[model samples]
Target: MLKIEEIQEIIKLIDKSSINEFIYETNGTSVTVKKSADEYTIQQPAAVTAPPVIQQIEKPAEPVVQEQAPQIAAAEPATSTKKTVDYDYEIVSPMVGTLYHASSPDSDPFVQIGTKVSSNTTVCIVEAMKLFNEIEAEVDGEIVEILAEDGELVEFGQPLFRVKK
Candidate 1:
């Protein structure tokens, strides 16, 4: 495992370099640092685990006291409550990448709230590595909400939009 001083030195090197991302792995340990516009993200390896320590405590024997059970309120009827309708369809990202709402900054977003979309409708662009992949809405529905923001890094299976089916 890398020491704290070593990790701090690595971070300083990254900040001084022009690289957007840096990754290092060795002996089952891995570290990743990603830098974008104004922020930096770091992914550290899981902590090393040690064997559990066993301990013993002595207590004096005493009479057992019974406690009264707490009462729970009765549940209300489901029909008496108002609930918002949920969307059945969601557009998810296919890979880990940065999401783009439009082809260019000056262009309008492909889909907005209440915008109807079909299987062939191109909803957004996901840039991974150096490739730009256009994501489409596989289900026919109206977009109810965009779960991801433009230029944000998205992970695989992350929901990008909620569509009303």
Candidate 2:
């Protein structure tokens, strides 16, 4: 069983990190921490000697579309003026992590706009839990856009770059 202070510390760490969910188990006790939007929920068994009881917390839905109506309307003209070319492929992040354009701080980015890449060419690195994962282009194409910025926290399946075959 986790003490209150220990559980608080874990919550603090998770809140600061990019992790969406964390689970810890010891003996027969289990603790789960989950983050949804800006809220955090901690779920744990009430006691070790009793049957585990699970409780769920839910939030009421907000009118997100209504709130963004003005912003979408405002950007319509700008989007209409720009030429829309359908991209052939999108290089996406495989996991939730911080995106790094270069292996090191002083190194050049692996790929940039107009840079041609092979299927196996590394385009960027996504650092998750201290592991630096080299992201591949996966398709032969010229990079048309770098969507995510360096050192940005990116979610799983988030587009990192757009490519034209």
Q: Give the clash count for each candidate.
A: 0, 0
Give one digit per residue, the lDDT tens place, for model 1 in 74-116: 2212354645548998899999999999999999999999899
Q: Score every model by TM-score.
A: 0.51, 0.51
RMSD of each: 17.6, 13.9
| Model 2 residue 160 lDDT score | 94
Prediction 2 global C-alpha lDDT: 0.76
Q: What would the TM-score be for candidate 2 when compared with the true structure?
A: 0.51
The digit string of per-residue lDDT tens for model 2 on 32-71 reads: 7775554556666643553554433343443333211111
